[model samples]
Target: MTLLPDPIISTWLFSSVVFGPWSNHVTGWWEKKQTHSKLLYLFYEDMVEVNQITTSCAIKMLLELEYSIQVRGRVQFENMKKNSFVNYFTSLAMDFKISPFMRKGKVGDWKNHFTVAQSEQFDEDYKKKMKNITVQFHTVV
Candidate 1:
C-alpha cells in the first residue's frame, strides 16, 4: 500500500483513480477505511461531470482543516460537511490554473484507450497481485 500524505494535505486532495478489477492502491485504503475518512474517493468521470476542480480542492482543504487531529474529537461531521467553498478561494483564484487538475474522471475510460488484450492483461495481473487479499472486487459504474 502507498503511504498516505501528510494529514493536512490529504484532506484537500481527492483521488481521481479508484475503481474495480485494477485498483490495488485504492483497495488497500478501502481495507483501512476507518483509519482515513479524509481520503476523498472520486473517479475520473466524476470530475468531467462536475466541471470544477478548484472547488473540489477547496472543499477538501477546508475539510482537512476542520477534521484534523486538533478538531476531530470535538467537531461533528455533519457540521463540517455543511460548509461550502464558494468564498474560500477568492484571494488565490488567479494564482492557480484549473485545466491541469481537470481530467476525464470516468470509469472504463481505459476502454477507449486500451486494446482488449491489454485490458485482459491488467485483469490477470490484478488477480495475481491480489491473490492473498480477501476483499471482493465489484464494479462501481
Candidate 2:
C-alpha cells in the first residue's frame, strides 16, 4: 500500500535496474552459496552490528583486526566517504549530502515511511515475491 518509491521493503523489489534489485541480487548469491564452496555472502546487518542495531560479526572482526593498521584505515565510514579510491562507485551512484547513504539504519524503519494503505500493499507484494525464499533473515526491531 505504501507508494513511496524509497520505502525499504519495496526497494528490494523495485530498486534501479542498474544493479537489478536487492532481493534478486541477494537471493541469487544466497542460492549461489549453495553450489559454490568458497562463496561467502553475509547480510549487511551481520557486518555492521553496532550501526545496524542487530546481530553483527563485525565487532569481533574489528577487535581481531585492531593490530592491523591497514585494515582499520579502510573500514571507517568517514574515511571511506572521503576516500575516492574506496567510494568511486558510490560517488557515481549517489550524492550523500542530498540523500545520505546511511539513514537511521534501523530494521523496521521502513514502516515510518509507509502509509497504512501502502503498508498493506507492500505486505501483499512482499509475500508473493518472497514466498519461495527459503533462507530466513531475522532481526529484532
Candidate 3:
C-alpha cells in the first residue's frame, strides 16, 4: 500500500488512507453514543429503506433544520452531488472518475475490489488497530 502515493479505494475502505485511521473517528464517538440521546450510531447495512427515512428525519429534527416539501423533493440527493462544497468528487485532490463517489452501495461490495492478499493485510491491521474499539461491524450483511 505504501508503494502508491495515493491510496486506492481498497486502502481507503480499510481505513487511515488519507487522514487518520477511520477507527479513531469512530472510536471517539463510541462511549458518547451510550450517554447521548442525539448520537445515532449506525451501520449502513442495517439501515433498510424505512430505517433510512426515519433516521434522516430524526437527524433533521435533532439538528432543528427545517426543509419544505417541495424544496426537499426538488433538490434530492443530486443537490449534494452537484454542489462542489459538499461533493469531494468535484475536488482536484483526487479524481472521482476513476473510482466514482457513489459506487454500488451494496453490502459486501468490497469483495468485488479486494484481493486475498489485500483482505488478509486489512484483517491483520484491523485486529491490531481495533483492539480496543467496541463497535462491532460486519463486512457482509
Candidate 4:
C-alpha cells in the first residue's frame, strides 16, 4: 500500500494489502496516475516475460528515487522472485493464516484459482473499473 502526499492523503491498496481496504480506503493507482505522471505500474505476471529487463527498469526507477545502495541491491528481480518475495511473504501469510502474499507469482495462476464463472465476473468488473485506462496485459503466456 502507498499513500499520496496530499492533504486528503489518499491511500491506495496494492494487492499485497493483507486485510484489504477500509471504508475510505482509496482504491487503484488512479490518484497516483493522475498526480505522478511518471509512475509505472508493473504486474508480477508480466515480469515473467522479461524478468531481467523489467527488473532493470524497476531498479532504475528506484535509483531515480535515490534508494540506498543496500536496498537497491536487495531489490533485484531474481532476488524478489526467489528469496525476498516468496519466502518473506509466505512467512508473513503463515504468521497470519491468510492467503500468502506470494500467491504463486506465476503467469496464468489465475486459471487455477478462478473458475470460468469467476473469470467472467473478474473480466466484467475489470472492464467496468478500467473503462478509460490504457493498461496492457501481456499475451505471451
Best by lDDT: 3
Mark the 10 consecutive residues where model 3 has the least summed lDDT.
1-10
TM-score of 1: 0.35
Q: TM per model?
A: 0.35, 0.53, 0.58, 0.56
11-120 in candidate 3: lDDT tens per residue? 66465654446666767888788789778776656543344465566557554445434434433445545555554644466676675554455677777666667777
Q: After superposition, how far is residue 33 of candidate 2 from its true place, in Å?
A: 1.9
Residue-level lDDT of model 2, residues 1-141, one tens digit each, is 234654654555567654556567767877887998556555545545554332223434434644455544555556556666653445355665675545444566666667777668656766776788777764542
Which tens-of-lDDT digit does each residue in 14-71 have in candidate 4?
1434444321122356556667856767776656676667666776775654554555
Q: What residue runs in model 1 are displaced by over 4 Å at the alpha carbon?
A: 1-24, 34-101, 134-140
Q: Return the lDDT, model 2, position 118.
A: 68
Number of the candidate with higher TM-score, 2 or 3: 3
Q: Highest TM-score: which candidate?
A: 3
Predictions in order: lDDT: 0.45, 0.57, 0.61, 0.52
- Relative to the unseen true structure, what is the C-alpha lDDT of residue 77 in candidate 2, on a scale of 0 to 100? 56
Candidate with the larger lDDT of 2 and 4: 2
Candidate 4 structure, TM-score to reference? 0.56
Best-first order by TM-score: 3, 4, 2, 1
Displacement of the residue 60 alpha carbon in candidate 2, Å: 9.0
Q: Which pairs clash (backbone N, Cα, C closer than 3 Å) in model 1?
A: 44-105, 44-106, 45-105, 45-106
Candidate 4 minimal-lDDT segment of 10 residues: 5-14
Which pairs in model 2 have colliding backbones?
1-117, 1-118, 1-121, 1-122, 2-118, 2-119
